[model samples]
Target chain A: MKKWELKPAKDLGLPATERFRSLRRESGLVSTGMQLAWWSMVRGYMAVWHRLQITGKHHIPVQSPFIMVANHASHLDALVLASPLTWRLCDRIFLVAAGDVFFETPMVSAFAAGMLNALPLWRKKCGPRAMGQLRQRLLEEPCSYILFPEGSRSRDGQSTGFKPGLGMLVAETSVPVVPCYLDGSFEAMKPNQRLPRPRKIRLNIGEPVSFETVANQREGWVQIAETMERRVLELAPRRGA
Target chain B: MSPAARDRLFGFSHAFDNPVTLVVTLVVGSLLLLAPMLVWWLAWTGRIDRKMKSELITRYWSWLVITPLILGPILLGAAWTIVGIAILSLLCYREYARATGLFREKAVSAVVVLAIVLRSFAELDHWYRLFVALVPFTVGIIAIVAILRDKPEGYIQRVSLGVLGYVLFGSCLGHLGYLANDQNYRPILILIFLSVELNDIFAFIVGKLLGKRKLAPNTSPKKTVAGAVGALVLTTLLVMGLGSFVFRGTVLAGPGYLAFMGMLISILGQFGDLMLSSIKRDLGVKDMAATIPGHGGLLDRFDSIILVAPGVFHFINYFVGVGADQSVHIFTGG
Candidate 1:
């Protein structure tokens, strides 16, 4: 007989708040249910409120161990990107969110972790160690991530340079990074806005890119980030097109 | 529902109607009140160090919150008690699932959860036949739902974990909830809880004073042979003394029957503790989860009650029949 293999939850011993902020957090049945409900509601809201549109939907990978990187402009970017995915992927798809914004307070942390199914990234103190753990979880658990390579929401309508932290996750690995472009989110809900307007939104998903040959170092991370940024830029609708 | 059944379900006015309930509540209340003084005395006398003192205080605070949460439901009404137990069953199952990696199999977990809800419903409706029927029905459902994944690899492990989870958390703990169906459930549950908790304390205290030989060192390093025997003797006596009051006029009032029931509680409670210990050992974890501050997880604190619930439930049920005189199919109106 084969030996029984038991792998306990990675965040088993952490307290509730710490568990929310930990990169090792894994969603159980309750959180999964909550995320599904919340995401389904978000999907409906995006469809009705924003009249969200998608292009190249078939470019999205159907399996795990993939990364979806898009330009960060508004609070609704993650929601918009995740809305197009199938319901089966709801539990496995984690929106990599900013710690200070999403997990600063206990109540906010609960909402972010429980409803959004997000894992925290402490932008101020994000070191290679944190990135390494994220990379390991991405490949080991074979879970997909919805990331904004610009690290934070863009204050203005223009996108920012992609951060090297995104490269650290996919570099020297076979995991595919799909670049997506989101339009009209900035106009709908800017960083300073409290509420969103009913502006039409569009999402264009580019083909997935791999960084298997890229080194897991400074230059390689930069190269991966630049390549991803270029791919996302190529998907954006040209001016007055 | 009849007035009697109504009183048993939602009648908080008669929380202290039974003498046993009153006495147990007072005793638990006194213990909670006096605990702080005792801790202060120990700290002043320097019997325990600062770290140990702080740990004890943390545990006390946790219990301070936990005791009210537990006693409130039992006193509120049978309906609340059953609901509380159902919630407990779900939480315990969640911890077990996360620990054993069983929650990953969403289909099997959902079936187990649904079965537990159904068990709670059966208990509330006072439908014994359906209550008994659900065990097999759930097992069958778990087996069927597990195969839906169509992945043959590790099928046995998944099914076995799901079944074990259901049996331990849903079925065994469900018996405790079913006890609330009886008219005199408040006192009976209080006695069982008191004895089971004191059984652990007795074992720890006695083991510290006189324990020399280790009992299942690999399973639980701290448990000693003396502790097991001491708890067995002390808990049995506690039950015999308390059982006479709780079971007053029933056939279970007899010393012989009470002794047997007490022994059963102690033995099964110890076994339950050992069972959890074995699980933790196998899974390479110290505590199930960091739920309760100083005590580890809810499972750690309530492990003794799990097996004891079913054992004592059946023992009493066979002798006197639980909820025998109560209205059946209260909700369904059959």
Candidate 2:
């Protein structure tokens, strides 16, 4: 007879706000309900208001343990990148957001964790130890993540260089990184704007890139980030020539 | 609701109608009042160190909050009592599910929760038939719901966990809520809760004084055989003293019957405590959750009452049936 497998929740004793920011966070029955409700509302809003269009839905990975990296140009980048995924997968997918903006206050942390199902990336203090914890959660839970590699949202609606910190997450793992580009979200909701405008947005998803062969080091991380950046840049629409 | 039913449901003026209720309330109040002085005395005499002193004080503070939350509802109305138990069932199930990792299975968890709520509704309606029927019906539903997953792997584990959760939290605890259907529910509930809590206190104090041999070391390391025997004797006496007043004119007022009921309360109350300890030991957790500051969890504090509720209810029920004269199906009007 096989042994009965019984494992308790990782974030057992932590309070609500602490659970929200915890790297060891795992969704339970209540949070699953919350995610389903929040994601359905976001999907409806994106469809009706943003008139969001996706060019390559096939490129989205079928299972989790993957990363969706998009060009960071607007506050809506995370929302737009996450909008196309199935609501059934909402509990398994987490949007990695800035700690300062989304998790600095208790109220914002609650909103981010409860509604968005987000984990904080403390950019200023994201040492190797923190990155290692994030990596551990990804592979261990085999969950998916949605992140913008350009660190912060763009003020002028242009994609910046991808940061090498993205390398620390998937440099040597079998998890694939899906490159995506979002156009017109900066106009829809720029960093300076309080509310989003009803501007049409287009999402272009490219094939997933694997870095299993790359060494888990500074040079390998930079190369992986650069390659991912170029793939997202390729998805942008051609300009008049 | 009928006038009679309304009176039973929301009548707060008759909170102290029964002599037993008045006596139990005063005793609880006096204990709470005198607890601090005792703690201070212990601290001043160096009977306990700083950590033990702080833990004892913190536990007292938690009980201060918990006692009122529980007693207030029963004193207010049967409706409030039923609702409070329902909330407790939910919270206890929440802790259990999270600890067992059954919360990951959303479908099974939802079914268990729904069954608990529906059982509470039956209690509130005073519908005895529906209340008793919920256990098997829910067990069947939980078993069938897991088959919907279609994966067929770990189906036994999922179904078994769901059933265990519903039975312990929903049905066992629900018996306490169902007792409120009786006309004299306030005094009866107060008597049972008071004795069960005091049972734990008796065991702790006695064990500290004369505990040498361990009762069940693997299951509960701190429990001693001496503590169990001591609690049985003391708690039986307390129950008989209170039971005589509560059942003054009934057949249960006899010495033989009162002694049996007292023993039942102590013995079953100890079993309940050991039962939760075995569960925690198997799961490899110290406490269920840090819900009550120093008490570990609600389950930790109330474990003795879970089995004692039904045990005492049935024993009294066998000799002189409970709620036999009271109205049944109060809201259903059948």
Candidate 2 chain B, run of 10 with poorest lDDT: B325-334
Instruction: Give the TM-score comparing model 1 with the true structure, all chains together.
Output: 0.98
Best by lDDT: 1
Per-residue lDDT tens digits of candidate 1, residues A155-188?
Answer: 8878879998888899899999999999999999
DockQ of 1: 0.80
In candidate 1 the C-alpha lDDT for residue B56 amounts to 90
Q: How high is the lDDT of residue A3 in model 2? A: 71
DockQ of 2: 0.72
Give the alpha carbon lDDT tens digit for every residue of B120-231 in model 2: 9999888878988999999999999999969778899999999999999999999999888878889889988888888898999999999999999989989999999999
lDDT (Cα, tens digit) per residue for candidate 2, span A161-199 = 999999999998889999998999988887888999999
Query: For residue A22, what is the lDDT in candidate 1?
Result: 88
